[model samples]
Target: MIANRAEPSMTETSSVWGTADVSSGKGASDENFPVGSLLISKALRPHVHAYYAYARVIDDIADCETLTPEEKLARLNAMEDVLLGKREAITRQDSMSAAVLRASLTRTGVPFETATDLIIAFRDDARGVEYKTWDDLLRYCKYSANPVGRFLIQLHRESLNAFPASDALCTSLQILNHLQDCQGDLIRLKRCYLPSDMLALAGASQEDILAGRTSPRLRRVFNTLLDGVDDLNRQASTLPSHIKDRRFRMECAAIVELAKRLTLRLRREDPLAGRVALKRTDAMHAALAALRGWS
Candidate 1:
């Protein structure tokens, strides 16, 4: 998720997403999946980039610091209106990117509601909401992460039969991101996504999170969460087999591999000390796994 920030100047050309570059540099780097990977057909690349741009812009608004909560809500509402056909575009500055996203949805026949669900999640972020249980966190993933996978699946014309596996894969990736960025989310945004009940079971509190240290209790809590993530990774391992499209199956395999690798790293590394991320070599391994269609 990106915070309030301007797009990077280097991507200002229309090369990246078939629209003006609306990416905040920070957001681009934070994305875990290969947005323009070769595994995706060339025809689908534009739609993928458009979807990513829309998500990036919305996340930036929710995460932006200079804007008040009220302002963020207003901006999100305006974007939602555009997505829902209530308006044409956000502003002259955003019109091209907005048009590209709208066109992609129209061409792919993906429902506007998919994008709106993401808006709902961003609204929660703007309001500084917290999760009380693992179920509550999953509900958040429903809006925040699952829709991206759903939209891509729809774009590929895959059967709805694949959705369950897609959801598991997407949710696992979301959890991996949450675990990796827990420290930053707490320190920078005053947000915590870890379930309160689990923290309590581990004898940890929100204060322990604020202290920015990995105590034994906190480690136990994270280990418990890691177990759940591992389960999801296993569930998602079947996704590639379920996908009918060969290219999409490869892409799914790659994402699952990346998620599995990241989950392993999160299991060992302390989030508070520094960020945990995949190296370029790790990404290459994922790509090769995709090429081989390895689940």
Candidate 2:
């Protein structure tokens, strides 16, 4: 496991959700998503980029500990206020989150309420909260992750009937994220997404997690969790068909390709040390496959 090191400050707190001001030469190449520059219809690209930026910002605020609990809540609320147009403008001093929220709301045409729910989820993170059961985690997913998918779906003007499947896909993705970041969350961030009840059922505990080794008991527990992920993936496979529009179908396919790559990583039998992020080459291959099917 990696040492529990503090997250480095890469941007001003308010801009963590937007592009960082990297010098042209070196680290600028490492940006995730680069959705800003991807070759797509100009009208659609900005909305997609705005949603990604919003999600990125909330994730950074939740993962990074630069703010106190009170401060996190205030920043989140302020961002929601900005989304509602209650604030004149979000200053850099306010929180990068507010700026992202403003951009996200403006670009995607997402309702302020949806962004507010996401902010509430980040507020929950400030307290280091954990769920006690699958239902609890699903409720968390409702606020933490599902809104992003729902917002994107709305941007495409897809039917609401697809929301159930989208919810499943979004929650599955969230679980995959939890699995990938298990080691980092325990050792580096001192947090755990595994429910206490499930840990007890698996013969593991918070202490066992912090110990940084996967015992046979932990393996058994991890396998059970993986079973759940597999089921979710199966359900998610049917989601793309729910979106009849070719572009939205392709987007869902791209997402499925991402889930497929993560599922591949989980096939390994070892104690993880940090996140098992997907390689870009694999994603590109998946995108090509998706495009082929659409064509």
TM-score of each: 0.88, 0.79
TM-score of 1: 0.88
| CA lDDT of each prediction against the hidden true structure | 0.78, 0.64
- Deviating ranges (above 4 Å) for candidate 1: 1-25, 90-96
Q: Residue 153's C-alpha lDDT in candidate 2?
A: 70
Error of 2 at 153 (Å): 0.8
* Cα RMSD of predicted structure 2: 8.1
| lDDT score for residue 90 of model 2 | 33
lDDT of 1 by residue, 24-111 (tens): 3354667777776777898887777777777877887788767778988987887776665566653343443555576678767888
**Which 10 consecutive positions of candidate 2 have the poorest summed lDDT?**
20-29
Give residue 256's lDDT in candidate 1 (0 to 100).
91
The CA lDDT at 70 in model 1 is 94
